[model samples]
Target: MACCDDTCAPFDGASPAYRRALLAVIAINATMFATEVAAGLGASSRALLADALDFAGDAATYTITLWAIGRPLRTRATAALLKGLSLALMALWVLATTAWQVVVQGMPRAEVMGVIGLLALAANLASVLILVRWKDGDANVRSVWLCSRNDAIGNVAVIAAAGGVWVTARAWPDLVVAAAMAGLFLTSSVKIISQAAAELRAAAAAA
Candidate 1:
C-alpha cells in the first residue's frame, strides 16, 4: 500500500469553509444520535433506532473526515474504507435486530415517530445544504455528502412508516422501515468502499 492516492483532480477538503461545515455537521449528527436513541427507546420505534444508528455512524464518519483532511490521499481513502465497513456493520446489526423485533412484535408509537422524524429530516436537510457545494469530490469527500443525503431519505421513510403504523396498528411498518434502512446503508457502504478501494489501488500504482 502506498502513502499517496488520487493524483488526478485531487479534491479540496482542507478549505476553511468545508472544515467549519464539517464541524457543524458533526455537532448536529451527535445531537441527533442522542435524541433519537432516547426517543426510540421510549417510543419502541425501530425506525427511529435505525435512524439513530445512522446518526452515530455519520458522526464518526465526519470525525474521520476531519482527521483525514490535509492528510495523504492514501490516508483519506483508508479512512473512507473504514467508514464504509462500519456502515455495513451498522446496517447488518439493524437488519438482524429488526428481525428479532418482528418476533417480539411491539407496536411503535406513531406520534413520536412522526415528530422525531420531522426533526431529523430538518437537521439532515441542513447538513445536505452545507455540504452541497462540495458534493462531487473524492471518495472521502463524497462519503460525507452521501451520508447526509441518506439521512434525509431515511427521515422521510421513517415518517412514512409512522403513518403506516398508525393506519394499520401493527408493528410490521416499523420493522419494514428498519429493514429498508438497512438496505440503504448497505448500498451506500458498497459505493463508498468501491470508491475508496479504487483510490487505494490508484495510489499504489502511482507509488
Candidate 2:
C-alpha cells in the first residue's frame, strides 16, 4: 500500500537467496506433512493429524510465497488469499477430526505420539533456522515466515503434549494442543484474509 519501499524489499521475490530459503523450507514441510499424517493415523492422535494439516497448509504457503516473489502486488495479494483459504480449510479439518477422536476413539496410541512428535519438532526447528533470516521481510514474505514460525512452535507443543500424555496416560493434553493449534490457524487466517482483502481493494482502486 505504501508503494513498495524498503519494508517490502524482500518481497521483491526474485532474490535467489529468498527463493532458496523458501524451497528448502517447503521441502522440509512437505516431508513432515506426510510423516505426521501417517504417524497420526498410527497413533490415532488428533493433535498429530492437526499438525499434519498445518504442515500441509505451510507447503501451500511456501509455494505461494515463492510464486509471489517479484510479482505484482495484485499477484501477491491473490496468493495471500489462497493461503488464507487453505489455512481455514485445514483448521476445519482439524476441528472435525479432533471432535471425532474425542467422542469416539478414546485414548490414542501412546507409543507413536512421542516418537513422531520428536521427529516433527526436529524437522520444524531446522525449517525455522532456514527461514529466520527472512522473518522481517515484506508482508508476503513475512506471512510465509510466520507460518513457518508458528509451525515450529506447534511442533514443540505437540512434542510436549506427547510427553505429557505418556506420563499422565490421558488424552486430554493432546486434544488441548490440537484445539490450540486450531485457534492459532483461525487467528492467522483472519489476519491474512484481511490483509489480502485490503491489498486487493487498493489494487482495484488503482486499476
Candidate 3:
C-alpha cells in the first residue's frame, strides 16, 4: 500500500527546504551507521548489527532521493524501486547473519547494547522529526520517512532486547530482536516497492 491516503496531495520533490532536510537526515544516518556498527561488533549483538545495516541503507536511500529530486517522476519512482530492493537484500543478509550468530555466538553485553541502543534511538528520533512533515509524500519521499520510522521502532526493540537479556542472562532476546528487525525491513521494503510500482504505472499512463 501507498504511504499516504487518497486525500493527500502529490509530493513536492522540488522544494529546496525538503532537499536540505534530507541532506541533514543523510548525515545523521551515516554517522549513526558507523557508531552502531562499531558498537555492535564490540558488544556482539546481532540486533545492533542489523540496526547498523538499516542506518547505512537509509543513508544510501536518502542520497538516492537527493539525486532524484527535481528529476522526472519516473526517475524518482525508479530510484525508490531500487532502494526497496536494496532494503530487501539487506534484510535477508541480516536474517542470515542472525541465524549464524544464534548457532555460534554467546550472550552479548547487555549494558553495551542498552547504551548504544539508546544513542541510536535518539538519532533516529531526530531524523523522524525532520522528515515527519514528508511522511505522506510520494513513494520516493515516503520511503525515506518509512526508513526513519522503522529505525526508531527497531531502536526501541533493541533496548527492550537488552533489558530482556540483562534479566535472563541469555542471547535469545538479542537474536529474536534481530530477527524481528529483519522482518520489519522485509515488510517495509515490500510496501515501498508496491507504492513505487504503482507510481511508475501511473507515470507511464500519463505519458
Candidate 4:
C-alpha cells in the first residue's frame, strides 16, 4: 500500500506534530468563526455569512478529525462520512439563506467585507500552511485538508465580492459569491463521501 494508506497502517493522530497542528487549526477556525459571524451580521454580507458558517463547520469537523486520527479504518471512514454530510447540510443552508437575502434586497457594507475578508484570508492561509504536510491520507485526513483548502478559497472569493460590491454598489456579487461557495462545499462533500464509502467497503472486506 502507498504511504499513510488506511488499509495497511495509519499515522494520523499518532504523530505529536500532527496533533499539535490540528489543535492550532481548531483554535484558528473557532476564533475566525466568531469574528466572521459578528462581522457578517453587522455588514449584511451573504458571502461573509457563508464563510462564517464554513468556519464553524470546519471547526467541528477538525475536532472530529482529531478524534478519529488513530482510529480503525472503519471508524475513521464513518467519521469522514459524518463530516461530508455536515458539509452538505451547511451548503444547503447557505443557498437557502442567500435566496432569502435576494428577496429582501440590500447591499452590504463593502469596507467591512473587505477588512473582515482580509483577516479571514490570513487566518485560513495560516491554517493551510500548518496542515500542508499532513494533507494526504485516508478519508478522515483528506477531509481536514479539503476543509482548510475550501476556507482559503472562500476567503479570497469573499474579498473579490467585496470589491465587486464596492464598484457596483449591489448585492449581486455577495450573493453570487455565497452561491459559488455553496457549490464548492457540495463538491468537496461529494469527494469526501465517495472516498469514505470506498474505505468503509475495504475495511469490511478486511474484517
Best candidate per TM-score, number?
2
Question: Per-candidate TM vs. native?
Answer: 0.79, 0.81, 0.78, 0.79
For each candidate, the alpha-carbon lDDT, in order, equals 0.77, 0.73, 0.78, 0.76
**How would you encode candidate 4's per-residue C-alpha lDDT over 1-207 as one tens digit per residue?**
001112212345457887888789889989998998788778888888788767766676667767876568798888878767777777787788789989999779999999999999898778777876775747646654555555667788899999999999899999999888777667767777788899899999999
Give the per-residue lDDT of model 1 (tens digit) for 116-142: 999999988787777666667467466
Question: Which of candidates 2 and 4 reaches a greater TM-score?
Answer: 2
How well does candidate 2 match the true structure in TM-score terms? 0.81
Weakest 10 consecutive residues of candidate 1 by summed lDDT: 1-10
Instruction: Write one digit per residue (lDDT tens) for candidate 3, span 165-191.
Output: 999999999999888877776787788
Report clashes for each candidate as comma-separated counts: 0, 3, 0, 0
Report the number of backbone clashes for model 2. Answer: 3
Rank candidates by TM-score, best first.
Answer: 2, 1, 4, 3
CA deviation > 4 Å runs, candidate 2? 1-18, 132-150
C-alpha lDDT of candidate 4 relative to the true structure: 0.76
Q: Which residue pairs overlap in candidate 4's backbone? A: none
